[model samples]
Target: MSSPSTPAGDLAFVVRTIARTAVDNEGAFGDLDAVAGDGDFGYSLARGFEIVLADWDTLDPGTPDEFLKKVALVISKRVGGTSGPLWGTAFLRAAGAVKDRTELDAADAVAMLRAAAEGIKARGKSDLGDKTLLDALIPMTDALEQRLAEGGPGAGPAELAALAASTARTSADATTSMQARRGRQSYTGERSIGSPDPGAVAVAVMAERVAAEWDVRD
Candidate 1:
């Protein structure tokens, strides 16, 4: 139940969480993507994480921004297809938003999420309700902001992250009924209605991991 309080620990947690998720749920994501996409989304992300895992020890323990930039570069280079660049851009933008911060508080997390959302939208030319990962991410950010606003003056990162995870999961599930308006799935139009976007599910999984791994801290 130990929680991360430093830049290196935080970066390590993200690496471990994503790698574990890729291992446990890659096939599931592939199956979901097959319904509308090329069925490689899962494999692509997993490969990116494999690169991340291989170079884990080399990741910067200095600024959070540097650590995230390294991860973003790995994803951009190792992962294939649109997801690679878009996800990489998201992380890169988020890292820029955080600048040289050594540790993230609730506000820093929210800012990073906001920057990530904007990055995804710009990189993919998509937005909320687009039946993409943005669907889950937008609602998750909204929920986190709401939680931070309503959790009173002493609002903690754990509660905000938990709310983000819950919102992401709910939004991801709701994507099953949505029609694709962006990405490879858009070619299917209404055919994507029954399957949740794999990217969205991936986002939800990441959020869930963050909540589970760091909620004990605050």
Candidate 2:
């Protein structure tokens, strides 16, 4: 395969990719949210992406950081509930990680993902095993980091992203057995065990998108 293009084009592709993912999974996300939240997770994300699509032409194409900052602003302002701020913060953190970079390599992608995961952790004040999005994100980032650390000469962004995506799916599935420790779902005590966290599902979706869309070449 070929290497991915510069950050500016990558941003545009990622936006479109996420928008499609949101629309495709909105119903399932709502169903998952209905298990613990107000069932608005899907609608909120779809709406936020809709706004992004509408404003696609205006997004800055100069750098990945600027584009992600714009994305964060839109998600925070247009989406409602905790998801808005949480996701926005993640994107913002990613933007900061890549600030001033015109292109992103495999290691940069790993760093950005790691930054986003840490952002979610700090912003949500949540931890692993919290039965939140962190469950999926943390594990995925860990897997990516491990790949980057171990695969020395051959590891590429697409391969690492695929590994992370697989880990995300597994982590998200594991959430079904974990009782919620934070968020409104915590009120359910043991009753929330049957359903996975919607946010976790969304994180898995993001991982999948990155794995599919990112170009990986040495």
Candidate 3:
């Protein structure tokens, strides 16, 4: 909001927002996952992020990369099931993208997101059109990067966030017709076609939350 003042501050805000979103939407997420998966996605994510919030004051904030790595360690160790490794890897890769950078810009943001998506793709052995989170995440990142590149009208932070959120939502909704190709949902075969991928929906929801609160975040 109002252009981030510091890299550390921006990372703090985004992480806190993500953690809180996970905690707050546990029931909805769990219900979504139950359609095809084991229904533990929300539970696992909330449990891990709860620890993140509980230990917020203790997490290193000396630098953006350091903070993200610390968070990644916590996620990998505390989160259960597949969510742990995938999400942890995402944070780790994002941290690497900004390694030693004292400040960040729009390009840094794009790079971090790209790194995170690649990490998720590798860790989950999934890709776009796999009916996974990447379905939403990658498209969202591309939209943001493209918008920034175009520098079109209303290409500010809030607008870019809104664009990303919208793209993620659209992409997630499109997963409803796609048969699952990865994760527990794949076991359901055609049954997974009617329902959206929980991970994709989760990504969309988180992006939406971030966009809606972008201007108001401290």
Candidate 4:
């Protein structure tokens, strides 16, 4: 089957893969989030994505930015906690990157990711190695940029998605061994060693889901 690039394709993948992510992460995100903040993160996220997928068609956000803004607003209203705002911001920024696109190319995807990373950093003021979503965002953006540069902007979404997944996973997994120096988890100090940050987990889940949905598995 041809891979997804248009709004319809993005819609289909998002609906199915988001549910898969919630199933995969289960309580892990909630449990860790409870340590320093409200415990509703995973639940809120799952609920929000469920809602987003269900009304995804009706959303008809017009442009990518509008689509993301709609999701951000919907998620913020329907779900409670920092997760709603954080995820909303990420989507909003990515959406902004492709406001003019009906279908995102490899370069367009890279722009989306770079915008996403910048949004997270701007909102959180955290840098790479802080063990936040930037952990995944930085690597993922770099991977996309490298792939696009080497293979040209015409590189397929599946291949780009594959590289993005690999990079995100690497960043997410590496956090398990490192100490979190950012966000609420920073207070945990060495205690945060064994558990991955919920935000990082969320990033990994989103990237992996998008990769699979787009038929990009490495």
- 159-203: candidate 3 lDDT, tens digit per residue: 877998999999999999999999999998998989999988999
The lDDT of each candidate is: 0.82, 0.81, 0.89, 0.71
lDDT of 4 by residue, 47-116 (tens): 8777776776666533556666677776667666666666677778887888766654557667877987
What global local distance difference test value does model 1 have?
0.82
Cα lDDT, model 2, residue 136: 92
lDDT per residue as tens, model 2, 1-218: 11236545555666667777887788989888998777898988988878877887788756789888998899999888887898899889989999988867767777887898899889888999999998998888788777777867557655676788899999999999999988778887998898999989888897798677676311
lDDT of 4: 0.71
The TM-scores, one per candidate, come to 0.91, 0.90, 0.95, 0.83
Off by over 4 Å in 4: 1-8, 11-16, 32-38, 152-154, 216-218
Candidate No. with top TM-score: 3
Pairs that collide, model 4? none
Model 2 lDDT at residue 201 = 89
Q: List where candidate 1 sits over 4 angstroms from the true fold.
A: 1-3, 215-218
Ranking by TM-score: 3, 1, 2, 4
Positional deviation of residue 201's Cα in model 1 after best superposition, in angstroms: 0.9
